[model samples]
Target: MLQSYNFALSVVLLNVIGPSLSNCSVNMALGMWQKLQIFLAFVQSCSNPFDIVCPHKSHVQFRTQVHCNSTRPQYMCLYDENKKQYTEVCVEEAETQREGYNTILRGGIDGVPCSTNNYQPFSHSSNTGGSCAIVKTSCNDEGQLLYDDGSSTTDRSCRCDYRVGYDYVTVPSNKCFCKPAIEDCSCYMKYCDVNQVLTQDYKCARVYKLTGIFDCPEVSGLGSKDIEKNKKMPSNATKTGIFFVQIDYYQNKDKTYHGILDLILGIAIGMIIASVVLLSTADILNVVRLKYSHNDVIHIVCNHVETVVLCSIELKCHLESTRHCKFIYWTKRINGDISTITSRTPGIHGSTVTYPSLTLDSPLIEDCGEYVCCAVYDYGRVCSPPIRLTVTGDVPSFSVDNELHNTDIGKPVSLFCKIYANPPCSNVVWKKYEDGQYTTIHSDSIDCSQTKYFTFTLNLDTFMESDSGYYFCYATNIVGTSKSKCITLSERKYAPTIEVDVDDNYCFNKINEDVSMPYTVSANPPCTSVVWKKKGDGTSTTIYSEKIASSPSKHITRSFKLVNLKEKQSGEYFCVATNEVGTTKSQSVLLYVAEAEDDDFSSDENRSTVTTLPHRRTRYHSCPSNWETDYYPIKRRSRLLS
Candidate 1:
């Protein structure tokens, strides 16, 4: 009987919570303790009392990440299997007990306010879930009143604007509405129009009109009976939407000097009436506003900058009443002279007749000042806001335009030199040390920055093995010339050029006499291997061999010596230099050996003839235009070694 009773109890409890259960697939293998907890908290589904969800029944999962932000979050059970599900145990463990969940709005359908009531994001399914946590605003924002119903995904639209003569309904029912002042006056006495003011002692009171400037000119016929409000009336009538003012006037005449007084009075009255009519009908350019693009002072360095000076006539209806919509652009220079750039006539109501700006191309600091646009009407003229323009100047300083000055032989080289000379740069000089001489390099003007930054371009048709040297750039401005840095072009690889010097030889019978054949090698990698050879029987025999570099033999050439000379020493001899690129052989010189007694012959016969070879020079420079360096030409003269 007790088992039967427990079965009955379980059935009854399931029936009670069945409807509230979600379709979420339940994890069946739960411990008995968890089952007990579920039984205990069966009716308290998320923090919301209206939501009694059973995960097993819904066949979906839920995860709650709640932050009670400005949107006022309420705990909800969103049913979407695809989304991460908040476990029921976590919800129960959190503030759901008493304090409630401190979370943002949820996604997917739950028992929340707009969740299921106006759900339309997608069809409801166990696989789909999550809550719309997007921040939502109620119509009650800014004291606005709600006029129509809204859904959970949409915001409640406000009803009326209190600033435009409506007051808010403070009651809970009318929380979303701003209503007419008359209907809300009793409870909302604070709302008042600009013409009315709220009094500390009572409702809104009419502001009194002062004299002179405040005096209204009489309209000859319209509502002239009671020109001014009757102060005799009770205050209550004025409190309710009374929006008009009244005025009164009195006149008296004396016949003592009737004729003369009448003349003077008639003239004064005519003048006053005429002035009033003219002032009322005439169009004043109060709308002529100046438009300056920048709020701060403009600074320029020999650069092009334009200042905007626009005039806009906002009176569309009054435009037809004006004679012309002429505008004049004027400038106040640093010299204190106010010069007019030009004038435009009959400009369109909303736009300038032409581009309305003062373009100062390559201007000096002397051109710095103020600029303004003015609208000229028949009676008067009005100017727009003034704009401040400035031109700045500084000394010239050049910088390298190329990062690296390495080049391959026979390839074209383009070196660029650039400098910022606030006030135009006066001159630029390029110096190069190439081909054994210090010569000037001519640079072409790169017009791109000619009006702004000083830029020079030096272009070489082709780079040669000899075109490796230092270059320098000099730029001059008002202040002075700028110091330059050197740019050196290093040749990656080059074949060696070899030259040999010969000494006049005659077979000297002296025991210590020797004939020397000295050689020089010029190669980028500095020929590493050099061999001295003597041509014999259509073939050559190597006499000397060694590793040499960087023309180390520049100041001193290595030579093959033939000491203890004899007639048998006569032969054709030469030296060869080799690097990674290629090899070069020096000019072969004939070594003549003779007997000392045989000197009786002619000097030509007695002397061994010497031969010389001529070669061209090369140039290399680096700078802002890539024109930087002291490129002094290096003469390729081979010196004989001891």
Candidate 2:
């Protein structure tokens, strides 16, 4: 088959085929050798267990995937969900997949299966069309990963698994209830199970979930003795805490209770009839909030480059309140002790009990840990929820060369991903993106393989029209993945090449004699036409013309003879091969048509000796298909036409 570029996968096969094409002949055996080699390799790579393989979204640029494995050897593989099997697609086929067709699944992507707990089966777009994709999944704060076995297409879902000690409750359960597993248990039944036991008071008791953090102290009412003292002296009354749960009565009952209760009831009744107000407010307030400044994420991951993080501390208070207060920062290193970052009293920019922002700035590696916000007041101190600030590294940033690449078919080309990242990128790989989706260009190896040139590169030994498109590099670290700007690239195709079998050779014969010249060519897309030209006196003249038949193998050699050679027929002759890529001419050979006969050389100054090669075959009809051969050269002076 002709070396057609498939848009599905941008594969570079010429590095392997380009060198081999040089030795093959465009004769009857055309490209048999190269074809056989390609077929065998393709069969070996895609034989079994591999399903549908997708090609690069755009092939204006292409690259080869590292060999997969011995059994299912391929650049990338896809599992057919419905078929429940892996279908092998050889590396070549994977690179040159057809565009706008062929659905490529991402189950067995990057030459391997997606991470069980990390990646979920997803779909993406290709060439502006929808196709299968493999994406990563994440869980939220109140979620738990109950099960994950690494399914490429199935996303692991978070389950609700509530725990007692680890969880919290706003109100402690003073009373506990039981829901029996017995199907016949009555919903209205308030009795304990048969295995349950009652307390000393003949009451059933059970443990309840622990309260979240801490609870405020309960209020205690005044003692009976104190109430009696107050009642004895009607004018000596003082405020005392009261609680409804602590009411006491009988025997030494204080008559003051009756008087107070009657008075309170009278006031409550009058209030319901518009004697009192229904609104209340508290003035004491202390609120604290902490977060990183805009785009500052040293609080996320460590970075090799110099970095900074502004921990913005927000204190909520009333407006117009300017209470100068001390602002303190703290740092807790990983697996280390917490240390205070001393600070001076910040000139309060707003009113006390008002919202004001306090900021702490630093790039210290020790600034990675949980944080607490505290707002001190005359009455007390209030603290906010803890926040963990990690400074492991910053998200990576990089750039691409975006240089233009121009080349013809059967030629080699290379592209590089010149990028700069902080904390250095843990992994960098090429990817083809189209229609809001990206296709990985390499199989992640042990830590992922690195392409050479500028540290990361994509080399295409050879590609076709389909191998033209946009490509870019993707970098990743512990922080996250970063995408570089895409570059538009194209690999121009060219025509086949023609060359003379022997260089600087001349064919001489007397006028009216016949001369046979051999011309050899190596072409792709099979040269559609051939022409013979003789360059004489500053101009080129076509001496022979013929249409060449297309062939799978166009590396050919042909011999054409000029009968009854005339003086004008003598010149430099060369062969031209034309294909879709372009046209190329072979090396020129000198052709001399002389007026003197063989015997006229005996005339003194112009006389020359005639030497014959006894082992050599006769000339005039000698034409060999092979261009790469061992042929001795003869000097033009005193050399006979052979």
Candidate 3:
């Protein structure tokens, strides 16, 4: 009867919990244990005084207390075929006794919350051959209770934001988001609204899921204002979203800025007005100065230091409305060279020497030195400051019209030698070559300051053949000496005037023995020298040199004594006179020497005949063209009849 009662009890508990079980495959195994509390609650409500209460059932309360006190065992059991249905003993041993505890093993469906009429509390399984699981339920004001399947710890209370491709969302909870296919859609505040339209299940890998719902506020001016929020979208993106932005407003200006602008305009206008006034006033003042003032000094500017020859230093005067003036006489002093500045020579120092009412040309300073050009005006003499002249030797300068040419011989020729030097020079000399020799003629040094081009003509009289060759004029000062190329003069040919007739005895003597005669001849302007040569042989000798007389025609004589003479010397004697200027030869003179007569022959053969004298031959030589007439012609003697 106890076994039959236990079987009936299992069947009843199974029936109570069967319907409450969830559809989960694991919950089916819960059987009657799933709804034990609900069944008990029903039992208490249905009990009558006349019904029989099982003794085992009365221990349900005590057994429940004991099960609660023991640590729940985590184990699984299966049928062991070798030991045919492992004994119920193992199950009884695992269980502990509790006062009024009653449990039966069975299979049954678990009771659900909706069917429990809200009377059920917390419960575990109460059926035999089934495992017990805990089920908890919560209730609402409608007296309805909702039960958890007891399989999971989570609830359906939370919701996530839904979005599609490339959605922007925050991390962790991932509450904020931006709409997909949009540019610059990063969340600035909360959730972006357009982002919610996308599907949530379609999320990207390595991307945070929007697990929270957030609302975005409406931006009033975005896409609504005249200006577009964005221009271009990224290549992969389709649209750009406008975001809420905060901005501060400002405006400013001041009175100082307006005042400055006014000041600038006033200054500009004043300047324009001042310019017009000054223009008219300056014209009138200039006229007044030109008419009333004599000290209207004008400045001059020079340009082109080298290669600048004749340049006009322009002269100008400011002509007031009342006055007019003309250029007067002008002069310039350049490095001691004096010259009148005129239009012929327009300018010298690259430009004209300019002055008020007096503009004049300038002179050239051939060398580097200090030069000044003094202008003489109608009022007075106004001198310019010493202008330093530094001329490059790249283009050398020459003093114009300062040389003399076309000179005559024997007469003095003066070469005007001038040069441009800074400080005045005193010493001047004339240098020349004369008779294969050099001669320097000195002149008295003279002061030269007032002249711009200091020059002196050299006087070279008493000239000789050597002196006639080439003449040079040199001028020197403290600075240096300047040399001019030689001015050539050919020696003039003139008849040699016989000024000397020495050796009169030699001129009129008869030649009888071997004799040597030595003589001299002199002439003017001055004889270079005297020479003698044998008529037949080319032998010649020098007799006199560089000898001269006071006057060109004065007679100066030289004497020659002969010791021995031969037939060659006895033939004819003549004298020649010559000078570097010219030469003249004297007429040939015939000299007679008695020849020894042939002696008569004495007796023949007995005594040797003796000759009385040796025979002598006579010869004659003519004088050359270097001397005057110094000999008489020979007169033939008449033969005596014997």
Q: How many residue pairs clash in each candidate?
A: 69, 44, 62
Ranking by lDDT: 1, 2, 3
Give the poorly placed runs of model 2, Cα more than 4 Å off: 1-395, 402-415, 420-424, 430-472, 482-497, 502-504, 509-515, 522-529, 535-540, 546-556, 563-572, 576-642
Model 3 Cα lDDT, one tens digit per residue, 417-519: 5666544445556677777866887765666644446666666665544544666766554445676666665544455554323233223222333223434
TM-score, cand. 3: 0.22
Tell me the tens digit of each residue's lDDT in model 2 across 1-642: 011111001112221112122222212122332343344335424433222233333421231234344453434334455565434344422332332222444543232333332332333322221232333233222212222232455543322112101111121231121111111111111233332212212233221111111222211211111111111111111111110111111122345654554465445334422311121111101111111111111121212222333323322222121243322232222454433222332322321223322233433345556543333322212334345555444556665665567666667777766655445566788787767877777733324323212346787767665666777777775456787777666654457776655324656566766555666667656778888777867888666677766576657776666655567766677878888878887777877676854443333342123334457432222123233332222223123223
Q: How high is each candidate's TM-score?
A: 0.30, 0.28, 0.22
What lDDT is reached at residue 349 by model 2?
Answer: 33
Off by over 4 Å in 3: 1-415, 418-442, 452-455, 459-471, 474-483, 488-517, 521-583, 594-642
RMSD of each: 28.9, 39.6, 42.9
Ranking by TM-score: 1, 2, 3
Which candidate ranks first by lDDT, i.e. highest? 1
Show the lowest summed lDDT stretch of 10 residues, model 1. Answer: 618-627
lDDT of 2 at 440: 76
lDDT of residue 236 for candidate 1: 11
